[model samples]
Target: MRKLKLQVQMTIDGFVAGPDGQLDWMWIPGERDESIFEKVIDLAESCDTILLGRKMTREFIDHWENVVDNLPDSPEQPLAQLMVNMRKIVFSHTQTAINGRNLEVENGDLTVAVQSLKNEPGRDIMVYGGANFASSLISLNLVDEYYIFRNPVAIGKGLTIFTEQKILKLDSSITYKNGKVIDKYLPV
Candidate 1:
């Protein structure tokens, strides 16, 4: 069985994005710390599948594919290529069909679908989606590990992935030079 690891970036105030869905508080292009990207690479290398919600599937796939296609020499090429070629399962109620080579549509019971995936023999799976989707996974006790990257800044009011109270056992915590802290936690 493989673990389902959720990786997300959040503000110091526990918000994933601002109230208006603004992410300006995060590191800008020239200001981004390379450590963050490196950390993501480490996680990406450990995963062979990506779980996404209906809302984020298209944008996430297109962005990575475009970045790798246009910027052949991009610094993020390694992660981009893996993401582009990896198997992606989108949880959507309305979307009955998906159009892509490695894409799959899972409109069945979330728990059943996820459990079936977890029981498969493969590399770990990673979750990438909106707050609601993440919250759903957390609420259902489906996430095996959490990789939370907490930025330095705080947005007082915004979207948070933690809607229900969860007791987490910290597996590890590492802080980068850019004031970003990555905490690995397991459900207690």
Candidate 2:
């Protein structure tokens, strides 16, 4: 079975994004070290499938497909291409169809759909988010790993991590010298 990993960039205060859904407070382009960004790219490359919430999928597809070319040569291009080529499963009731070649729309029950995918033979699956969707997966104990890029800034109020009914226990956590902390948790 393929591992399902939830990868997110979060603030010190545990908010994934600002109250307005703005991620401007997180690490900007100049603030990131080249080595760290490269590492992140490599991490992204390991996944064969990307699981995304509707809003995130829409925004990402718009930017990666349309706006990537207008930008300069950087890591975003390669990341965008990688995202475009990989298999994408966008979970949403409103989205009738997913627009790319390897993209698929999954509007049925999240747990069943994800379980079916997990049973398939493939590289690790990546869950890129919207907190509500992540919370659902967390509640169902479906996520196998979490790769969080913890930025130094603290946003006092926003979306909280683990917005689910079940309690989660951290199995291990590693803090990097660059101020990014990666935490791993297993469902108890």
Candidate 3:
């Protein structure tokens, strides 16, 4: 079976977003390093399909589509194209039917949907999260690998993906010059 990986940006204190789902803390004022962007592209190149919660689908699609349309000569262009061409599966309960290429809505059992996707022949599956969806996946123990990009700052109280305590073994850790950290972990 293909792996199910989680790629999330978080604060040092473990919050993924603020009380109002704000991400202002994550967008620090500074020039972004090319190496960090390259790491993102590397991850994108490794995955053929992306899994997302309904809450994140629209914004995610729009952002990447804009990247594909406007950032033709950027270092981010490869990731833009990869994101545009890759299959996207959105898990939702109420809303449905997003008309676009390589996009589908799955309103069935989360386990069944994820399992069937894993069973299919593919490189790997990646999840770009909104807090609740990531919490559910972590609670269900559905994630195979976690790629956590931790920023230097902390949000005292906010949304978190790991609602329940679970032990994970560190697979690797890479630190950027700007104090951003990427930690790869596997369930212990």
Candidate 1 residue lDDT tens string, 110-162? 99999999999999999976788899999999999999988888778998899
Q: What is the full ranking by lDDT, best candidate first?
A: 3, 1, 2
Q: State every prediction's TM-score relative to the real structure.
A: 0.95, 0.87, 0.95
Top candidate when judged by lDDT against the true structure:
3
Instruction: List RMSD in Å for every model shown.
Output: 1.3, 2.3, 1.3
Q: Rate the local accuracy (lDDT) of all candidates.
A: 0.88, 0.80, 0.89
- Clash pairs, candidate 3, are none
* Candidate 1 vs 2: which has more TM-score: 1
As for TM-score, the candidate ahead, 2 or 3, is: 3
Model 3 Cα displacement at 29 (Å)?
Answer: 2.1
As for candidate 2, its clashing pairs are none
